[model samples]
Target: MAVSMVGTNSLYTCLDMIDKMVSVNEGYIAKAILALLETEKCVVEGAGAVTLAAIMEGKLPELQGKR
Candidate 1:
């Protein structure tokens, strides 16, 4: 499933949102998201990336398998 983090707001600006579905048994995905955002300051202020981070890491089980 794909998690649509790009809301009606203009957080994404003009950056392209990349959605990738991944297995979630382990915490690798979240960890990766945190690491990427932490190390990559260029991705800062990009609402699309932020939304992707939430989808890949923050969302709960109820949110998974659906969006």
Candidate 2:
């Protein structure tokens, strides 16, 4: 979860969409971070890696053949 004193309305919206679609949580986010660090040699925050996590966890199977 990101803490922004400015506001989190947009963040909440994206999180809600992730929850409803892929049910991503902290575990997935952590896995994404580690995978990125190992493979891409990059560091990313939890929220920044949610989509990668979903792809890594095979939540987007529909895209397999399309790609």
Candidate 3:
């Protein structure tokens, strides 16, 4: 399970809206951060990079090509 400093309301909203959840390790998070920096010229913190990490790790194949 993942816990965050995010607000309860935001957590509640996410719980209500999301159909699935996936977990990625620190290595994936680090890779994601580097990927964003290297490819998109963007820098993101670990928590902010998790979704991309999941996608990169093939944990969310269903989300491929999604908007």
Candidate 4:
């Protein structure tokens, strides 16, 4: 299980993701990922905090396995 966000497109856009961060009473977290790929348009990657998607802070490591 890889712990990170993986994408092929050149998503080079960073905005205020504050609103995207949501908290649940069940002790779970969620965030929205908006990226501007080279092709244009915006891509949204919404994942839970426990998943690798939440920890995808530009630098993704251990592509073969989880950290």
Candidate 5:
């Protein structure tokens, strides 16, 4: 419906700005959370841990060996 479409403008805008998209499953998210909690002593929620999950799982190959 026209009314529901209003909220998706931001999603469209974001899509315009990105060149690539990647994803990780719940297991990867869980592992990232455990790694953070054990190694960094930090408590983070699933959404907050997603980027690190992608990195830890090698989803972002561009970041490899870049310090």
Candidate 6:
């Protein structure tokens, strides 16, 4: 099987930092994709789900309760 890689080189540094902060593993990615499919009725690839995964994993606690 051909393994596909996610994420872009332009955002690699930022993504790496977020991954470290939130532990963006396969499980979180899977949950993000499932959530998009169920709620938005659309399919999203791994790169596209990174932000959602971070949010779902609650990595941005600083943004909590801020509008």
| Candidate whose lDDT is highest | 3
Runs in model 4 with CA error above 4 Å?
Answer: 1-32, 36-42, 48-55, 58-60, 64-67
After superposition, candidate 1 runs with Cα above 4 Å error: 2-26, 42-67
**Candidate 6 Cα errors over 4 Å, as ranges:** 1-23, 63-67
Residue-pair clashes per candidate: 1, 0, 0, 0, 0, 0
Candidates 2 and 4 compared: the better one by lDDT is: 2
List model 4 lDDT by residue over 1-67, tens digit each: 2436634343233333323432232222223233322223545334333333333442234443564
lDDT by residue (35-59, candidate 5, tens digit) is 9999889999998788888888899
After TM-score superposition, the amount by which residue 48's alpha carbon in candidate 5 deviates from its true location, in angstroms, is: 1.0
Give one digit per residue, the lDDT tens place, for model 2 in 1-67.
Answer: 5444525786686775553456466788899999989988999988878887777777877655453
lDDT of 6 by residue, 1-67 (tens): 1237545774676775554444576788889999999999989898888778777777867655554
Q: Write the residue-wise lDDT of candidate 1 on 1-67 in tens digits.
A: 2447646555455436734434342344455555667877544333334445455665544466664
The candidate with the higher lDDT, 3 or 5, is 3
Candidate 3, residue 17: Cα displacement in angstroms equals 1.2
Q: What is the TM-score of each candidate against the true structure?
A: 0.26, 0.57, 0.71, 0.19, 0.72, 0.58
Evaluated against the true structure, the overall lDDT of model 3 is: 0.86
Model 6, 13: alpha-carbon shift in Å? 10
lDDT of each: 0.50, 0.74, 0.86, 0.34, 0.81, 0.74
Per-residue alpha-carbon lDDT of candidate 3 for residues 1-67, written as tens digits (9 for 90 to 100):
3666767887797987888867798899999999999989997899888999998888999988887
For model 2 the TM-score comes to: 0.57
Clashes of 2: 0
